[model samples]
Target: MDLSGKVAIITGSGRGLGLAYGKELARNGAAVVINDIDRASADGAVAEIVAAGGRAVAVVTPVGTSEAAGELVATAVETFGRLDVLVTNAGILRDKVVWKMTDEDFDAVIDVHLRGTFTCVREAVLRFREQGGGGRIICIGSPAGQRGNFGQTNYSAAKAGIVGMVRTWAMELQRAGITVNAVCPVAATAMTETIPFLAPHIESMKRGEPLPAIIRRDVGMGTPEDAAGVIAFLASDAAADITGQALSIGGDRLALWSHPQLTATDFHDGGWSAEDIAACWGQTFAGSIESVGEEFPEEVMPK
Candidate 1:
């Protein structure tokens, strides 16, 4: 996808998937703004992009705060003269089962993933309106959120909330030529290194070896570049008509997720009694009530 004159701000782009996205966009001729909390990493990314003959600037700021998010957009506009894409890829993970999860864990994850995405998108929308042109908002999501993970209540909830934001903003911003979408990627990155099942493969890749066919086939393991391709496509003008979608991308796999809707219903005159509802519950919904993590066996699951 060509993004010749576009200016994009990719949060958490100091390294990993966000850095991959910035590099991909820059490679495709878009001016990039790399935002990260780590100053050295952000500067390193900018230096690499510039050395490769791409235009980029590093913005060292935490994305979890409104002021920082606003500064991110302002930096893009001031440096590049216009903003065309905003990728909310900044996030943190704090994993624990509900009972063991602390308030700090839950709040931190939510603040960086959900609230940070909101703040960045809000600022980008304001700039897009001022420019009087279309824009793109690409939010990062995860498979854990789509199918709840065993010990990631906070992380899953935050990612799920991002999809909700995507759908709502897509509708609210369509008239303004803004397309909002989320990419649910399962790539081998620093984030996925925490998964025991994927850690070995990530290490193997880091050592410049090809992953085993079984691991690649089963889990669609690949580098961050694999996911960045999808994000770049969504940021292009070619995807102007596609909005409010949760597209899953990993290696050679790509899939679209279905929105939640009522699958079955039982109705009485006004409302049914508790006893009546309980009597019909099994027949009406039991078969359709899906179990989580049925696709992966227990032995293969991350501990």
Candidate 2:
């Protein structure tokens, strides 16, 4: 996946998973545009990339607005001459149960993860079209999006919406020679270090200690760099035919997540009334009700 001569914009790339992605893309020869709301962090990330012999520039801005999104694309083109890839990785967390979530909390998460992605991808697609219809759009997703996560109503909703758009965009942009896909990644970053189960591992990693296979293989948690390769592959010409897929990667694991589909189907002539459905509810659809979220009982997890 050689990206020589390509230009990429990676939002929220000042640190953590975003920074990892920016570095990997640049390592593969793509000139990167690093974006984040924090000016110091964004500049530091760019300096680090440049120090390591990569071409990189920073655009410090929150990505929810059309103007900011436009600026990111403009920076990529004006600085590097052309834009080839866009990674919508900017996001914020407003974790709360549905009943406890406020309007502000929900809106903040949606604005950054969902609407920011929409605006950024929209701008990138416009550039791709003007440059003659070929580009890559890789949106970040999560396990919460593919299934569900407790006390993460806003996060799950935003992530799920991102994947939803990925599917639609893949179809819409297919003939344009542009590919769209989502990557649901799990990594032990500052954001995940708050989790009780992952805290110790984070510390061990800081001391240069190796993680146990149980944590790495069973939990599928690893350094952000482990997930970065997926971005590099997806951004390369080798993956041009791999659009509309939701691929998960971390630690010793990498898997493809299936799209939502009907588990059961039935035809009712003239449309059956509610009363008619009540009679057969016990045998037909009731048993097929699928469980949602990350359903790992304590007994099943490796300790």
Candidate 3:
């Protein structure tokens, strides 16, 4: 997919996954706008892209703030004359269980992941609509959000919110030809390294230990490049009809996420009393939920 003449903005594009996306998109002919909170990182990425014969510019701005988000899109338009795609890849992690998670930790994560995504998309979607066409919005989600994790209550909740944003925006912006989607990329970045409790797993990774088998193949561990390909594809015209969807991009595997399947259906229409809700919760949380006579195989076990 040639993105020639298209103007694309990728948040957090200093290094890691964001940088990978910016590099690939620029190579594919898009006039890439690299956004990062750190000016040096953003400029460095732009330099690399330019050195490679690709067109790119760097803009350092906080994605979580409304003013900064607007400036990010404005920078693209001012530099490239129009906006075509937005990749919301900026985020932070505060790993803590719900009870132990402080309000600041929760807010920081939510502001960066959820609010930042909304800010960027909201600005880009308007430009797209004004240009008399739809545009693509690809958010960076996570498996932690889809399947609850031990100490990622904040991260998981923020990411889960991104999925909800995609679904809602897809419905609200489809009329204007806008397409909203998200990709849960599993790249080992600074965030992963900073999770203190993951040191053992990091050491294991260094030792080339493999993850459990039952998880989807494509959902296996991956590098930034693995996720970049999907981000680039979704931003291209080839994925025009695809919206309101979340995908898992890991390794050589790419799978459509069935995030909702993890949650069982509820039959009641009206609100249930507290006792009724307690009873339902008790039953739901009671025991194993695997298919009848089908035990969870070792292959599908968690890491």
Candidate 4:
């Protein structure tokens, strides 16, 4: 946790989870580079860090672009002298179902989440390699990437792509002493406040519209601080051996983020027919429904 003279660049550090991370890193002795599109918030964050006896500078730039990412990295090296840790925490949500989703929505989300991570990490990787040592690249991901949400197709795809990018980058950069990882964070912010619109719809429900009670239970739940601890760990020396892993931080839980595991997979290996695929789907659904136990009962949805 003693970052000391290490230079860290955090995207979207003006507010929410990114702000929390900047505060923590600065307090711990790292000279931080705070990046955000909003000049005011970015300046305010750096000022707070300075007021608290932490060295930091604010950079106003759009991280979704490669040029901006390079500029951000250059600012860190030029101002503080070296780049050591990078936390790509900038993102936006443009939620919509597949059919209702616009290309703009999909593009924007991917540009900010997936492409932004790529741009920033690629820029930092060069410095890490040139220095002939290890560095940390922490990308922000989401639970929607692990478990699909109804109206978050764009966000989910972008987040999932982030995990893929981290995994690939980890292997590609391992020899260069650079480690890449991801954190699937759940925070209470502007993004979560829109969840009422993202909640799943059940057409088969005889009750027609989804009840207000069910919707209320599922949205806007975790706090920004909940995500900071995990990001801090990934950005720390303690996590040096851990790379290409996706960890989830939400509420009171911290665990590895993973995809669904099937009882039997690889139907393609044996060349399954249509009937085999249909039967597999039927068994999987039945088993899954029963496995949920009381977690997903009919009364919750009300037939």
Candidate of highest lDDT: 2
lDDT by residue (31-81, candidate 4, tens digit) is 999999999999999998999999999899887888998899999989999
List the candidate numbers ranked by TM-score, top first: 2, 1, 3, 4
Query: How many backbone clashes are present in model 2?
Result: 1
State every prediction's TM-score relative to the real structure.
0.95, 0.96, 0.83, 0.83
After superposing candidate 2 on the true structure, give the runs of residues whose Cα lies further than 4 Å from its correct spot. 297-303
Candidate 1 structure, TM-score to reference? 0.95
Clashing pairs in 2: 148-293
Q: What lDDT does each candidate get?
A: 0.89, 0.92, 0.81, 0.79
lDDT by residue for model 3 (143-255), tens: 77787667887888888899999999999998888889989886556776654433444566567875433222523555567678888798888999999999987666777
Higher-lDDT candidate among 2 and 3?
2
Residues forming the 10-long window of minimal summed lDDT in candidate 3 = 288-297
Preferred candidate (lDDT higher): 1 or 2: 2
The list of candidate 4 runs beyond 4 A from truth reads: 197-221, 259-262, 266-270, 276-303
Q: What is the per-residue lDDT of model 1 for residues 105-211, given as tens digits with 9 covering 90 to 100?
A: 99999999999999999999999999988899999998888888878998999988999999999999999999999999888887888887778778989899987
lDDT winner between candidates 1 and 4: 1
